[model samples]
Target: MKPSTGRQKALAKALTALIPLAPFSDAEAIREAAGQRKLRELPPSIAVWIATVAHVRHEHSDYDALLDEGYDRDSARHFVIDQMNAVLTTWRATRLVEGDEDEGE
Candidate 1:
């Protein structure tokens, strides 16, 4: 619902950072906390996945369906956060990888 806390802010920041990379990152937290249960992590790929799914499919209910797909309560929550942050981390890694490519070019 409302990201009213510092943790929420951090999560939002992380998610935003991870968006550009796409097809990578973690995105677990963002998935679990879709309804704002806890802080959202959300990797770039998952972030894009969620956005694309939302845009193409149900609109907004994709996250809940995803959460219920397999993850238990804690597992879903933790994994969502981890996955999202992982996406962010992966995106940074991708940038580094691309930078290396440019250097070669």
Candidate 2:
């Protein structure tokens, strides 16, 4: 489904500032996924967050392999949290802090 042009444009604008550290291809993929979520009526920020995390989980972490190995979803995600956060740091989506709590899935 086609999201409204206004929302698309706005999302693109937000993403430009949000993920300046991301490579062009990664940014493009995130934008496309976020746009899909936006079409489902999620708020742009929420859509972007979901898309970004999913991308990091699938592309930059061992999440899928862990799942394939019979780990439950939460357990797999727990194991991959640090890897996911590292990717988010590279993308400028988050920063590491000493003593910071886990960012829940």
Q: What clash count goes with each model?
A: 21, 0
User: TM-score of predicted model 1?
Assistant: 0.25
Question: lDDT, candidate 2, residue 7?
Answer: 79
TM-score of each: 0.25, 0.79
Mind giving the per-residue lDDT tens digits that candidate 2 earns over 2-89?
3369878777766766666888788888888887833448767666666777787889899999999999987887788889778768
Question: Which candidate number maximizes lDDT?
Answer: 2
Highest TM-score model number:
2
Positional deviation of 28 in candidate 2, in angstroms?
A: 0.7
In terms of lDDT, the poorest run of 10 residues in model 1 is 96-105
- After superposing candidate 2 on the true structure, give the runs of residues whose Cα lies further than 4 Å from its correct spot: 1-4, 37-39, 94-105
Error (Å) of candidate 1 at residue 44 is 14
